[model samples]
Target chain A: MSQGPVRKILLFVDGSEECITAAQYAVVLARTLGAELAALYVVNVSVLNELFKARIFIKMEQMDYEHDLEQDGRRYLNYISELGRAKGVSIETHIEKGVVNEVVVEKARILGADLLAMGELEPIKSRSDAFHDESELILRKAHCSVLVVKDADYIERLYQAME
Target chain B: MRISGLLSEKTISRLTRTDKQGVIEELLDLAMNSGQVHDREEALRAILAREALMSTGLEKGIAVPHAKTRAVSEITMALGVSEGGVDFHSADGKPSYIFFFLLAPENAAGPNVQVLAQIARLTHDRSFCEDLRKAESPAGMLAVINDAE
Candidate 1:
């Protein structure tokens, strides 16, 4: 069954407080548009490698942190699924390991998403900060329409209003 | 997810049980107080069935008895410390001093796997396990977990 302009929504989450809010918004949007929803979590392995090169973490510590981050990504993705489940929206979940923005863009492209939903971007303190921010990079790189979710209270109410 | 949020003073205990079955019961009782469990008997059966397949004992004084069943509303966890040590048929053939009991909804396979991984990582740090075992009260034990996260 075809909905409106949106058919599939790919939600990119990174275990952030805002991602939970974004997930809520995505669930509500999916239900309203009758669109399929998939939540993606990237392990951001490159950041760990950067830390290792910076001498902030030794080999063992880097491996351990990498393991923890992978687990965290799975946990966050599962959380989004449960949120969708509660609203009677079946959500698919995916976890990948790579640079966060690159992985998200690749997954969205592969999934052929009609909309790419993400948490509110962090305040860009400078052009360099914006250049380095993964969320901003995702917004710039995605081929589909992007939805940067905000207003946690409003999203919560919308989610709660759903059956 | 913060491990601390899933646990509290109400969901932790200094186990009075000295045996494996006794300790499981004690932990389940603590889980009941969390108000997340839907069916106590089903949860217990699921845990025991998991034990029937293999022991959750991961060595180094830690035993993580867990299950995924419809009996839990979400992923619920209860922790216990056995000062005298309980024999859990650990991989290392050693007594288990700390127990991390986890119950998840049957459909929550992904989260269950992640929680198990997180527990494995926590158990890898002997000092963290030791701190939890040395904790005098549930609050103290909770503090150790909060600090580790």
Candidate 2:
């Protein structure tokens, strides 16, 4: 029973439901294929830029906000690692401070990951829609195989059965 | 950004759904009816698609289900409190009682993430969650949020 050629899997999580779902998929894929799993959380410094430029949030508040975001990143990374552990999968976690798309792609390349798993791209209204710009960039530029995991419909069906 | 500014009296409700997908659909429908979301079907699809990727169930009985999509013209929010918690496949393996549904314009990552972070911060406070849970009505929920802010 050959498990394909996947050796290393990189998962990008951001505490979103989609990210969490992707993490689950990554864990299963890793366990089934006997691949090493690594999760990355980018702090999204771009948000800080806007927070500072707008001066909407005071400096102290901004500091507190940034700290909270970092804490969130760490928490999510830990959660994913714990998920991996519970599933008997060895998972490596990376918490970095940078732009989301670039950081993910760079880390995936550096780790020589064979697959990059993430959530589905948000729907665009027209040709100019830019909702999932980071995802778009990663999909186009990543060296490894990109998997956009979406399972809402399946989940809905499961819940409907319960109803 | 003030958390209260993102939420309104109309957006807060007592959730009746006991399942994750039902709760999400109910909240998104509320946002759509409020005219914040431009397209209900598209928004629902995008949010659900995002959910399939991950469970937004955070610890402390809170879940933040969010999506950035072309279905919304702006960042919109709907907060639903369920007395009977719904199973959300949380990392903590606990049911989620408080649900924050957020829909944002495809390009507005800044506000979208900011609101999600704000909701997460609020949920971290045990007292705040308690206050929210104890809220008698939508107005009560808004009051708790305003006081916390």
Candidate 3:
């Protein structure tokens, strides 16, 4: 009941180490199934920008700093994606403006992805899946299976299993 | 380094603040006073509201209080180590001692995925959590965290 051979995986990242860990795990899957990978970064809206702008002089100087941050985010995503790209994994990035949880689901649907790999929070989520906390939410909303990743060492496991 | 990262001082506080609400308020105040957040009350409300939707406490005595907003410019983080664990109403029912309060711009959602991924990596390490628990003060805790990074 799925299109093609489940060869496309969507990954959501937030410039955190867990995100890089999730990306590492995703590369293993992409390599195994020859799946394409897409990394997404969402900058959850800043309350500081709104309140400060409303009450005081909206400093272009400070706002410029914010713009630079967005660039840094893109660079971080690019660096992570480069790893997958080296492994012959088709990797791409998308930066959108919105909330984290909501946008995560939205991007998955739009990508027509077969699987979503997220870093898992163990002891609560399987030490192998990050979305263990919100798997139900993402699983219920997305038209795909969400595999929350636990750690990069699992990639060794994936490779060993493949061998 | 991004200014957000600087907010994570290499310090550990042997604070004894008990419970979730108390920690939340204390952390919010610290975040505000440090200028980590623009509106103290508003950010607190957002964190509380997010908690209502679901506890930010994932596991391993780690609770990440995060909110997606259109109010800030970039993704900012504030971390605290409470000697006593705080009840996060986690789905798995665990007390989280390490707290990471994250702030993102109103139009920032993609960063959340990356941020979560990074956190997972940090949390999977037993040594990291063990050291956090062993921290004597806030500066010490931050030092350990920064050293890990």
Candidate 2 matches the true fold with a TM-score of 0.50
- Candidate 3 segments exceeding 4 Å error: A1-163, B1-6, B10-14
**Comparing 1 and 2 on DockQ, the stronger one:** 2
Candidate 2 residue lDDT tens string, A103-151: 9999999998989999887664322234335677888889888999888
Q: Which tens-of-lDDT digit does each residue in B51-86 have in candidate 3?
A: 776677775677777665543466666667766677
Structural similarity of chain A in candidate 1, as TM-score: 0.94
Cα lDDT for residue A145, candidate 3: 85
Q: Where's the lowest-lDDT run of ten residues in candidate 1 chain B?
A: B108-117
Single out the weakest 10-residue window by summed lDDT for candidate 1 chain A.
Answer: A49-58
Can you list the residue pairs that collide in candidate 1?
none
Which segments of candidate 1 are over 4 A away from where they belong? A1-105, A108-117, A120-148, A152-163
Error of 2 at B12 (Å): 16
Top model number, lDDT: 1
Candidate 2 clashes between residue pairs 3 or more apart in a chain or in different chains = A17-B54, A18-B53, A18-B54, A20-B54, A21-B53, A21-B54, A22-B53, A131-B106, A151-B52
Per-residue lDDT tens digits for candidate 1, residues A1-163, read 3458999999998777899999999999888889999999987677666644433234664576678677778888888889999999999999899888989998999998989999998785433344457898999988889999999999999899888
- Provide all candidates' interface root-mean-square deviations: 12.9, 12.8, 13.0
Query: Worst 10-residue stretch by lDDT in candidate 3 chain A?
Result: A48-57
DockQ of 2: 0.04
Instruction: Tell me, by TM-score, which candidate is best.
Output: 1
The lDDT values for all models are: 0.82, 0.77, 0.64
